[model samples]
Target chain A: AQSVAQPEDQVNVAEGNPLTVKCTYSVSGNPYLFWYVQYPNRGLQFLLKYITGDNLVKGSYGFEAEFNKSQTSFHLKKPSALVSDSALYFCAVRVGGFQKLVFGTGTRLLVSP
Target chain B: SQTIHQWPATLVQPVGSPLSLECTVEGTSNPNLYWYRQAAGRGLQLLFYSVGIGQISSEVPQNLSASRPQDRQFILSSKKLLLSDSGFYLCAWSVRGVAGGQETQYFGPGTRLLVL
Candidate 1:
């Protein structure tokens, strides 16, 4: 079964500092990876996705992710974090041609002011 | 300019009570709809999905069921809600890719169900 793993439960970073949220996925074939953010009591908003051809994918809010096929990782990153960037981040994966997405447990990003 | 809406925003009901959470999409047609449940500190679990009207697919065998009577309307129903069903329920929709590739899903505001 295809699955995603977000190792960190929470990550704390100061404002304007670089931040990284780690994610790894396991799938039978080529993986379709995605990153989503959810504010408190809100539904998730799509940040980025990696389907093919690109190792590094940039998303909304100046966030980006690198897809490493060898390590089975798709880690979300931002050069400079903001206080407003604090939220719940989720990594998801889908196997080839599958519509259902397998999501990670999620990582809470806490950007201190 | 597609949008998905789910209601009521929050629901409080006793265990064994019935549940009816409605989700509808505007400005889109023949989109794939999905129902997901998110437990505290956990990832979203896919409960059901529908590709078209009257076409429902169950991803997991659970106490809940889903229906798609209209092309853009999806409903999640449970005859007897359990205490375990207390969680955030989300409705999502995605446009089907013409080339059979994966499409990004857009989520609704979600309904927080508290089964006491």
Candidate 2:
């Protein structure tokens, strides 16, 4: 089955510290991975995506993700996290070229000061 | 630039009440429209998608129904609302097979439904 997995249910990070939210995938063909963040009572906002090419992809708000083909992972990362960065993050993936993204359970990030 | 709009930013309806949530896309033509629901802590669950006028595809089995009355307008309807239908409903759009796998779906602000 094609699915995305976020290993951690919640990630705790100190303000100004680097943060990482892990994600792994099980699919048939090349995976189109995407990351989305949701604030309280709001819709999801696009963060970054990994299609092909570069392994390290940068997204909005100084966030970046590394795509590891061998591990079938696309983990979201940020050099430094802010207290305002606390939100829920989701990892999504689709088949070779399907636009329908199957999302992971999601991981909540708590950046405390 | 394309934008999607969903109405009734928040709603509080009683169980068994009818529902009508609308979404419209501007600056795009023949786009793919989708309705997704997210529970308190659950990820998005795709409920319906429409490719064109009068064309609708359901992703899950539910009491809700969808219709594409026009090219850019999609409506989600339920004859009777259930407590299970309470959640954050989001409307999104993507260019139809335009960029292959790189297709990005833009979402609306979303409607928070509370059924009692």
Best by TM-score: 1
Query: Isolated chain A: TM-score per model?
Result: 0.98, 0.97
Return the DockQ of model 1: 0.69
Error of 1 at B110 (Å): 0.4
lDDT (10s digit) by residue, model 2, range A9-104:
999999999999999999888888999998988778999999889999999999999999999999999999999999999999987554477889
Identify the candidate with maximal DockQ: 1
- Give the distance in Å from residue A103's predicted Cα in candidate 1 to where it truly belongs: 0.1
- Give the TM-score, chain B only, in order for the candidates: 0.96, 0.95
- Candidate 2 is scored at a TM of 0.96
lDDT of 2 by residue, B1-116 (tens): 87788998999999999999999999999998899999876688999987789988898899999999899999998999999999999998888866666787878889999999
lDDT of 1 by residue, B8-116 (tens): 9999999999999999999988998999999994689999999898999999898999999999999999999999999999999998754444689999999999999
- lDDT for B74 in candidate 1 is 99
